[model samples]
Target: MEEIFAICDDITILRDGQWVDTRPLEGLTMDSIISMMVGRELTQRFPEKSNVPKETILEVQHLTALNQPSIQDVSFELKAGEILGVAGLVGSKRTDIVETIFGVRERSEGKILLNGKEMRNRDAHEAINNGFALVTEERRSTGIYGNLDITFNSLVANVEEYKTKSGLLSNKKMKSDTQWVIDSMSVKTPGHETAIGSLSGGNQQKVIIGRWLLTQPEILMLDEPTRGIDVGAKFEIYQLILELAKKNKGIIIISSEMPELLGITDRILVMSNGRAAGVVETKNTTQTEILELASRYL
Candidate 1:
C-alpha cells in the first residue's frame, strides 16, 4: 500500500458519493489528508469543561455483578455537577459496572447509595424511579424507537407526566414538551412527527439523551455516548454533557476514547480488567499515565 501510494502521481478522494479534490501525493501528508477529510484541524475535537460541584451525589461500594464477576469490588463516589469518566480497553468489563449500578444487570454483592440512602437491587424501573437514568451503549437496539416519530420517542420515558385528570394523554402538553426538547437540544428534524429512523446518527443520539433528561434523573450514566457520531456532532454532545453537569447532575461517562475522557472529564476512573486500577484528576493526568493505570490489573 505504501509503495503504491508512493508511485502514484494523483489520488482521488471520494466521500459519500461526492468527489473531493484530487491532490498529488508529493505534498499531501497524512495529517493534511486527514484535515481535508474532516474539513477542519484535528485540534478542535473536544469542548471546554463546566465547573464541577463538591457534594457527593452517588456512591457505589464493593460492586460485583452476578452475571459478570470480572467486575469485582469496584467502588466510586460521584459528586453533583461533576463529569466522572470511566476509561478502559475493550473487554475490561466497563459496561458491566455501570449496568450493575443502574440495575440493568443483577448485583450479587454491592451497595448503591443515592444521596446516602441504600438502593435495593429491584430493577431498571426502580432505579429510574430513584433518580437514576442509563443511556445504554446500544442506542439503535435499546435507546430509540426507530419506526416511531420524534414525539413518541421523546415522551416514552415519562409519558405519565402528560396524563390528564380524565386518564387520557394530553396532546397539548405532549406537543409542547416535545417541541421544547427539540428546540432545547437543537435536534434537527423536519417536524416532530418525522420518523426517528429518518434522522442522522447525531440527531438520534440527541433525541435519546433528551428522552432520558425528561425523566428528571439525578445520576446520568452514559456508556460510550459519542461512539459512532461524526466529529462535529461529537463536539455538540460533549458541550451538552458539560451543560448537564453545569445543572448539578452527577454525570458518569464510560468511553473507550482516552482523549475524550481527558478532554471533558473532571476525574477519570481507570479500569484494568474490570477492577479499579486508579482514579486521577483529568487536569493532572496525561494519556500515558491513564494507559499505565488502565494496564495495572492486566
Candidate 2:
C-alpha cells in the first residue's frame, strides 16, 4: 500500500554492472530485497501482498499471483555518509511506515531487521533498545518534554545508563552530558540547566534530537525532521543528520518537501496508498518524479 511505500527510503540502482557514485544511497531498498525481506519472490510473491495479511504465507502467495502492487522491480541500498528521503503528499501513509518501524505504530505482518538482526514488536522501548530512534513529525507532542529541564529532557531516552551506583541519577554527570550535547549539536539555549519550555522551537527540537542521540542508535527514523525550524536551524540539523549517516548510521527521513530530500538524500523513496509507489536514485530522480508519485494519492 501507499502508506508503506510513501515513507520507504529508495534503494540504489545498478546499470551496466557498476555502482553509481554521486552520493551514497541511504536507507535504500530493492524490490527483490524487500520481498525477500518478507520471505517472498520479487514479482510473483510481491504485487498482491501490498497490504500484507497476518495469516498464512500460502494466502499471501495466492494474492501475489494477482500482481496487485504492479510497480516494476526496483532496488537500491544506502551508503554511509548520506541521507535517504521518504516523500509523499499528505494521506499517503509515509508517516505510518516510519512510525511502525519505530514501534510507535504496530507492524502486524512484516519482519523488521536492524543491523541484520530481526526486531520484535514490543514498544518504543524495545525499538530504542535495538538502537532505533524516531524524531517524529509532531515534535511538540511526540519528541519534546516541555516541562522538564534541558538535562532531564535530554537524558530521558538514555537514562538507564546514567543511573548512579545507588540507583539515583547523578545530576552532575547528567548535566555534563547535557552540556556536551548542547555544545556538539550547536543548540542555542540560555543554559543546559534551563527549562526546555523557555527555549525557542528550534532549540526544543534540538533537545529532542539530542535525547535520541544519547541512546547511540544505529538507525534513526526522522519523520518531518526539520518541518517548522528556521532555515539556519534546518541547515544545522541537516548537517547533523549527514554526520550520523557518514558514521554508517542508516537514516530514514520523511518530509513533505522534495528539495530537502533531493538536496540531501542519496535517493528518494516515493510512497503512495500505503505502499511504495516508486523509488528513484538521487542522481537520477528529479522533482518531477516526486510529483508523479505524489499525484497517485490525489
Q: Quote the lDDT for 55 in model 2.
A: 15
Which 10-residue window in model 1 sums to the lowest lDDT?
11-20
Q: Tens digits of per-residue lDDT for model 1 on 1-298?
A: 3674768987776432347788888877766765665567766777766576779988899998887546999999999999999998887889988788888888889899989999985788888899998888998998899999999999998988999999999999999889988988889899999999888778899998998899999999999998877665688799899999999999999998888888999999988998998899989999999888888988
* Candidate 1 overall lDDT versus native: 0.86
Give the number of the best model, judged by lDDT: 1
Candidate 2 per-residue lDDT, tens place, 1-298, comes to 3444466455443322234333223443455443433234334310111111121111000001112232222223434444668887777777766666667665445556543456773589988998878888888887787887888888888988888899998878888889988988887777877888777677788788888898998777788887876444566677777777656677778888776887677668787656566677776888888889877755
Best-fitting candidate, measured by TM-score?
A: 1
- By summed lDDT, which 10 consecutive residues of candidate 2 come out lowest? 56-65
Error of 1 at 163 (Å): 1.8
TM-score of model number 2: 0.72
